[model samples]
Target: MLKRQKRSITTTLLTTLFICSLSITAHARRSGGPTPSITATPVVIEHIERNLSSLGSLKANQSINIAPQIGGRIVSLMIDDGHFVTQGETLLTLDSREQAAKVNEAKITVKDAERQLSYMVKLFEKRAVSQDELAAQEAQVERAKANLSSHMANLDYYTVTAPFDGVLGFNDLSTGAMITAGSNITTLDDLSTMKLYFELPENTFSEITTGTIIQATTDAYPDHPFTGTIDAINPRIDPVNLTFSARASLDNTNNQLRPGMLMRLNVVRPTIATLVVPARSVLFDGNDQYVYILDEEGLPQQRYIETGIILENKITITHGLAEGDYIVDKGVVKVTAGRPVKILSTEIAENHLDTVEPAGDARS
Candidate 1:
């Protein structure tokens, strides 16, 4: 019975040893196989831009409060609300009866003065009047002409005309309503283009210029983001806030935008040429950022890198990378440092990825 138990134990031990040896041989065989290929891309130069946000407001390109030039009772209202009117188009007509009668009276007086002046000229030529007497008659005619011109100019004041081409706002007053000089008649604004007002910190003022483009969104139309170009910058900076004001203009021929719309602006700083790589290639551990780059022998090596503003899924490599350096862009997680990798193929970048500039595009 002892011998049989011992034999059973020996058989079990021998079986375990055989299986272990077989497993080790299988692993060795698999390890000797070809190295797996990795997807790599060259670090290329790209223009990376930083984004900034600010709260702003929209305004009309040209806006004015329409008012009458003189006081009178309204006889006619030619203004059509919410419609565009050309410059010099009659907007309102006041009761011109008194003004017209005054103009006619002045005209008759001018004619009578001219007749007397002619008679005086004929008498002076015949030596029947002294030079001083004739000069006085000529002065009378001149005074009468001046008086007529004054009345005629005043007569034009009874009709209100537009200062420029613009769209009219609603007017509460109607015909026969009395208004004084400089009283509110309505509002007019040039809506062909809109002015966008915004402010930025003084630190970034160096990066901004007159042609810099700004993209904006309004709460009223969140989906429709519009764009404008910086046309003017206020030379004065806010003393307390340390910010400077800027103005941009955008096309608004359809009149979709108006004055005083709260807008959120997105300003892109000037782009700089720097080495860039795909965002997916980077891995973060603790606070250390790193990537797997291939050496000249196509061996995987772990490299630490510094990154900057990411635009359009491309990260700007501020450190630890240079243009033309090959890095694993796909299946980066599977790569092990110091491991050899086969050359599957290099991804030749045809065009650099970039953010589409919102300036000079068709109106939204």
Candidate 2:
């Protein structure tokens, strides 16, 4: 009986120990920390086309200032603001009575000198007049002709004409307004074809070329987008501003685009092949940028990267990362190196692997 009791005690102790061991294991599993939630984006090779945006103003390709070369009282204004005039069209007519009288007087003097010169030449030919006298008569005729031509030009200046085909501004001088020579009367701007001019930073000098497409917009017309090609570029950079001038030609047949209106320009630079990821995947610490990449075991590993400009809500990675990498967009803060991860959805995990794969390539 003692031997039986000893064997039974031994068996009971063994069983209790086994049960306790099982219970401890189960409790430890139950107390296992909660699984972390995370969001992720697959790294992919995308064409990274960058753009530089700037603000500019609309300007007419040509602008003309209407000013009289001769002083006179304004007799009439043939054109006003918003009036379209053709080239050589008379814009205004000034009082030219004085100029016309001067021209007539000069013409009479020229005719008298011509008659006197002819008489002197005939007398010289007949040996009745000295050669010196004939030369003096010829000089008098030339002087009178010059004076007449000057009066004729002054008379033409009295009648102001449009220098080019353009729209005129408001009349700066009204009838009976006394004006001096070179005084501005009105302005004419050619609006048929408008040009957009702007400056770019010196660093982007070599990247731009003629015929590069540019997109422009304005607050005045929110829905309309204007497209144009680079017409020209300044070869020399402005030392003070450290920029270069660029021009874009635009069509304005309807005359809707006016000069002095503000505009914004978007210039596309050269396209580059690079790896890109969602913007949320990037984290910055001071000047350093970093991301959480997955290791072979699906554990989070920190990667420091050099970044370029952001393109279309995606960050362009210049270095320290490559295509086919898996980055955690979310839940990165809770991750540590060498930690094990159990993927909740195998499809999501597989898709992440497939992200960088070219088309028609399957993920293993």
Candidate 3:
């Protein structure tokens, strides 16, 4: 009899607990769930950009391989490696004994022709020479002068001179070494300035232009960053790469930069108008991203958003959200759809050039 009474008490207790749970669930359903405390922020039109980073190649303002035009035995080398030379400075010389003899012989022939022409003029005046003969003598003198000029020009080929003011590279050829014509004797580079060559995608056509600022750094000197402006842009786009090449000139008066050094560059494009929201306010679920947007009824609603580049702590909203729309910025995790939120605070966007958002009241 005592065991039966104990069973009856246990059943009563279970029934009472079930009834209380039902009542609580009914009350919650009527109330539409609990309200969450959150901070709301209106989307703002902000200036944002994704800085472009690219690899570039460094080159001197002017660079060339120093070579001789004529082949002969090298008799002299006036400058060594790493030496600065001015334009038209004699750099190297080849054996010119035979060339010098030819020039002297040509000069003698010119003088003889001139002397004969002067005697022919006198003979023609005395009627001892025909008019045709006198004309022939004058033509011989002209031909002799042309021959002399040619020999003199050939004589200058034996000597090599600096083409411009620049720094010299290594000279492997020593004096008295036999070298062929067009053999590379050394290298010369005008390092007063540097040219940075890089490519940009065709999409940056409107944003990137002459006078765009760019910063570059080389692995050789990472700490030192070089700054320059885009001075030249290739008008033609590369058909294969779909990119256009640009040239930036940086002042290297100290001669710190060298040609052929691989450099990294950053294109500092100007920021443009874009819709932005706080990065922390956005939540990602698989491939879709969403944020809690407060509705006219003060209830939180789940709104999916498409995002673009993120700068600082703000993310760009490309679609699904417009400027001046309110979103749950703080306490987003606690926000539930169709549930009212306690307005802890708010941040509203001001449509002005100043761009600073004024704070809202903190009181709920």
Measured with C-alpha atoms, the lDDT of residue 337 in candidate 1 is 77
Off by over 4 Å in 2: 1-32, 236-242, 344-364
Model 1 agreement with the true structure over 1-364: per-residue lDDT tens digits: 9999999999999999999999997786557643444567889998666778899888898899988779999999988889999999999999999989999999999999999999999999999999999999889999999999999999999998988898999999988899999998899998889999999998888888998889998888799989888999998889999999999998886578989998999886776888999998899988999998877556678999999877777888989998888887766776667765544442422221121121221110
Give candidate 1's TM-score.
Answer: 0.64
True lDDT of residue 16, candidate 3: 100
Expressed as tens digits, the lDDT of each residue in 1-364 for candidate 2 is: 9999999999999999999999987786567654455555678988766788988788997897889998888798788688898999988888999889999999999999999998998899999999888899999999999999999998899899988899998775678888889988889999988899999999998889999988888888778988888989999999999999999888887677999988888997778888898887788879999998877656668899998878667888889888877787656665555454444334446754532222321211
Strongest candidate by TM-score:
2
Best to worst by TM-score, what's the order?
Answer: 2, 3, 1
Q: lDDT of each model, Cα atoms only?
A: 0.83, 0.81, 0.85
The predictions' CA RMSDs to the true structure, in order, are: 14.6, 13.4, 9.6
lDDT (Cα, tens digit) per residue for candidate 3, span 144-221: 999999999989999899889999999777888999989998899999999999999988877788999999999888
> Which lDDT value does model 2 have at 311?
67
| Clash pairs (backbone) in predicted model 1 | none
Backbone collisions counted per model:
0, 1, 0
Better of 1 and 2 by lDDT: 1
Candidate 3 local lDDT, residue 102: 95
TM-score of each: 0.64, 0.81, 0.78
Model 3: pairs clashing at backbone N, Cα or C within 3 Å: none
Instruction: Identify the superior model by TM-score, candidate 2 or candidate 3.
Output: 2
